[model samples]
Target: MAVPRVLILRAPGTNCDEETAFAFEAAGAVTERVHVNRLIENPKLAEDFQVLCLPGGFSYGDDIAAGRILASQLDRHLGDMVRQFCDQDRLVLGICNGFQVLMRLGVLTSGVRETQPATLTWNDHGRFEDRWVHLAVDKTKTPCVFLKGIDKMYLPIAHAEGKFVTADAEALKAFGDAGRLALRYTAADAGQASDEVLPFPSNPNGSEANVAGICDATGRLFGLMPHPERHIDPTHHPQWTRRAQQPQWGEGFAIFKNAVDYFGE
Candidate 1:
């Protein structure tokens, strides 16, 4: 198989593209940082890559909402192209603000309804929160390619509207039942993860059902609020020096590695 090429999509105010590109390249994949204008001008540019990633940042100055403007641009100008890209044997990932974009674009929850069934809203505390969080994955529920070998991750999250909420209880249950609820925030010392929502720092944003990330029915598309790209190296951890053992890589590195490995299979 050929080397997997990743497209790191960026828009105005998108600050995390470089870090995201570096993570992908380090994971043995080729990467290119493409601006939204360039893609809108020529949607065919998407065909050159096997992976599409929307990295973090305060896109459009977070006006009207974090990713609303960019999402509208894609919906109005490049909707069909994006749909085709997802329909093919490829993968899509959205991190931080990128996840907000995917949520607004309705790509992460595709096929659920004509309108988005879930959304990332304001933090329950009504303030921006920036902190390290422990995330647990639901391996049995989702076939998400990026999370193939990841059981848990310690990642940093910086956002004000990173809370995940479904339209209703029925929708939440439906997504959980179908395995679309792929990741959740959990206590650092928690032995086995549960659906019960954890308290303030543990759950961070107070997201419903403790959701920190989610995937689509196909599991090829994923969106998460935490910045995995920020933690690809062991030193990225806040307390690497105090650890009893330092691993070769950070917990988040597995995500990029898994994405690259998917092409090999």
Candidate 2:
């Protein structure tokens, strides 16, 4: 079987595309860093990539609002292409600003309204918060191909607006009940379970219900505020002192590994 080809998007001011690509490549996939402008210029380029990723960064300088302008540009220029990808059941992910872009695209849920059931903006503790967070796995949802069988893992998060808010509380509950909530923030001690309130760094931005990551109804589309690409190695951890007994398994790579394996399977 051949390795999967993943496309990591690169937009102006976005700085993490390289590391994101490295993570996916390390996960046994052939990765490419494609510039957003070139993608727009040649829309067919998207067809070559099986998985699409919008890596974390300050795109468009986060002007007006995070991912607003870039989202608008994509909506105006590449809307059909994006819709086509989604219709084909292809995997789409937005991490941090990428999450902001997906929310703005109005694809988080089935409908489009100012207050949709899918995505929301959340304020951090006054300023940008950057650190590691622990998350639990939701096993019920099949559409969540990336997190299949993952009970929990540690991923890094860096953002000011990382909270996930939604208008459809009931729908949100349904996702949780269905096990679509892929990850949640937790404490360093690993004392908190999935049912309880997610502690700081665990639910980094204090997201509603302590959600660190989520997927669409199909589970193919995923978005998270945490930076999984940052934790692809144990060395990325700040507390290397604790590394002796428990070597960090580099959980972030699982996201990419799962994607590749899903397509290969």
Candidate 3:
């Protein structure tokens, strides 16, 4: 068995690097926080790690749009390296802003030329959304490595442009047929959750199919709007004090463990 090494890639506005790194460390994997510029200076540096994580933040101050500037940098400079990383069966995890970057990197959605098949756009709310959300992962539909053994998760999401959309019927069918939709927003209780559609607060940015996260065609590349790193401890639960028996760890911690275990397997 091998210990997984995670590269928590960061940029000027990346605020969640420490927490994301800590989560991986807590999950028994070695981790590093590298700046995007440093990686751009040497794109081959990515080959040193087993996992690439684009942690959450207001990258480049979310100027122009969230994750756009960073995405452009990767697309123009290290796209091949990243594609090779995923193609090699290595893992890529994108939280919030990281998810935005993955969308533009074509890690989650691919196509010819500028004719992209899917994208994350402005939230239908027309403002920033910062709150916890209940997420449901259907293993039958998604082969996501980070979501193994996860049925329901309570994580926080903070982003304004996290809505996912695709106009092409073929593209939508492809995503469905391939089981690319890895996660979705659900009710506080999983049993009563709606399928494919939910209103604001429940659906957050109004992502079609209630999608809160998606995996690439291979399922090795996974990105989601929610912040799993924020909920590593039981205290993170909103109703922890009201529980009869408190769990030692938060629901989100399993995702980190799953990432590390992927390499262990």
Candidate 4:
């Protein structure tokens, strides 16, 4: 099978594009870091890639709101192109700030009108929080392409406005019923994943339903708060040195590997 091509989109404060590109490359995919302006100049350039990734960072200094500026640009200048890209059986992954962008662009919450049913707002603590987190994938739901073969993950998260909340109880129920709520924060020792929201440092941001990530109805487009790119290697783990034994790669590596394998299949 031919190797997949990944386009890592970056903007003025996107500091993770290089690491994201490296992760994809390590996963056996060809990757290129493209500036947002470059893609706006030639929207057709997106057609050449099998996967589009939005890595974590404070784009435009997270002014007004995280990812708002870049999201507006994409929505106004390249919305059609991106929607078409999704319809073409391609994949889109957004991490951290990128997730914020996708949410603001309404790419994740499709069919919503002028008001989004859900949004990522400031943490309940009203401050930036950065730390490693435990996450569980919702395999019972429509499987997310990026999360295929993954049950749980230990990844790092860094953000101030990362709390996932819905407009109301009904909307939250709708998302759960649709199986779009693909990932959630869970306790490190949790046996079975439940909707029960864990407390601070466990749930991390007081997100409704403990949501750490979500996928589109089709499961091709995904956005999450954790930084998978930062944990592709085994040594990236904070406790690697104290481990009795270690895996060949970190749990987060599988996320990118799954994206590349999706195309190979």
Candidate 5:
């Protein structure tokens, strides 16, 4: 099979590039870390990549609100490229700060521009929270290339503004009804354990809707306030007490593997 080329977006104050790229490489896909400026200067660069990943980090120091500056630049420079990506059914995965960027870019909503990208906002709690949580997968309707027919999976989350809110409540409901609610926090051992929604220590962020991640109406794009790259190995978890019991393939690693394999196809 031909290797899938993944683009890892980089910007001022953005971190976690190496880890995200490493995760993708481990998942069996070719990866590249590129600055947003490069893509802005040449939108055609993205044409060569099957996946675009906005990895976690405080871009522009998270100044004037998380992901605000980066989102504005992207809207101004690469908005057209983004639209074309969506039209092609290419994948866009935003984690943590990247999630904030996607939300601000309006890739998570459903309305006049719903089928494409929508918006995401701050968590109701109003504080930067970091921890893992379980997530329930509503796979009936989600058509995201990264999460095709997989059920659930665990991905550690670290962020203060990881909550997801939409201007239109009815649309959100319709999204769920259509099986577009990609990921939701749930009690531990709730069958959807891979979602990181176990309980207590697992549900760290306290997000509204217990939302760990979400997809747009079309599901080609995805945004989640989690750090799948953080937990690629069993050692990444704090639960040393159960190290022996931990599985060989940690939860976070699986998500990347899934993405790589999906794009590789």
Candidate 6:
């Protein structure tokens, strides 16, 4: 079978493209790091790949907002290509800043409107957070293919404006109802069972419902504030030396592998 192709969409300030692409390549997919401007010049270039990724970084320097400039560029020009890519059952993954761009572009919801139902905002603590975190995947709820066979993950979250807030209480519930609320922060030491508020290090950004990531209704499109690429290698973990032996691979690689497997099938 031919290896799946992944397009690692990049723009000014997008520094993680190389590592993110490396993860996908190691997972048996070929990757091309395409700049947003190139895509803007020829939107049809997106048709060449089965997966599209928006990796983490402060796009356009985050002068106005983290992903605002890049998001607008997509909304104005390549919107159709993006919509078509997801409509074809292809995949899209956004991490950290990429997640923020997806939210602003309204592509996460598969459409655009004057007002968004949810958004990524400033952390409750009003400071940047950079550390490892525990994540839980709601298998019953989310159709996010990237999380298949994964129950929990220890990944890093580095960002200042990573909080997720819904427009209203009902809206938040609807996400939960539709299984759109897929990834969440769990108590570091235990599985997700309690309804207790996960403060500080646990929740990181104090996102409502301890939300850490989410998928579209189809689950084919997903975005999260955590840096999965950073964890694709075992040594990337802070406690690698403490473990008895090196693990075969880091959990983050599973995400890209799933995407490759989906297309391979």
Error of 3 at 22 (Å): 0.4
TM-score of each: 0.97, 0.90, 0.95, 0.97, 0.86, 0.96
lDDT of 2 by residue, 1-265 (tens): 6677888888898988999899888889898898889989999999987888999999999988888888998899989878876778578888889989988887765633345676656565757887777776656443588887676777777888777766676866766766556667666666333645665655667677777777777778888888888888877767756755656457777888888887867
The Cα error of candidate 4 at residue 39, in Å, is: 1.3
lDDT: worst 10-residue window of model 3: 187-196
lDDT of 3 by residue, 26-77 (tens): 9999998998888889888888899999999989999988899999988898
Runs of candidate 3 exceeding 4 Å displacement: 111-114, 192-195
Q: lDDT, candidate 5, residue 257?
A: 71
Clash pairs detected, candidate 3: none
CA-lDDT, candidates in order: 0.90, 0.77, 0.86, 0.90, 0.73, 0.87
RMSD of each: 1.1, 2.4, 1.8, 1.2, 3.4, 1.7
Off by over 4 Å in 4: 112-114
Ranking by lDDT: 4, 1, 6, 3, 2, 5
Least accurate stretch of 10 residues (summed lDDT) in model 5?
191-200
Off-target runs (Cα >4 Å) in candidate 1 are none
Give the true-structure RMSD of model 3: 1.8
Pairs of residues clashing in candidate 2: 137-151, 143-219, 185-202, 185-203, 186-202
Instruction: Give a tens-digit lDDT track for model 1, residues 66-182.
Output: 899999989999998789768898999999999999999888887766766899999999999999999889878777888897788899999999989988888888888888888
Clashes of each: 0, 5, 0, 0, 24, 0
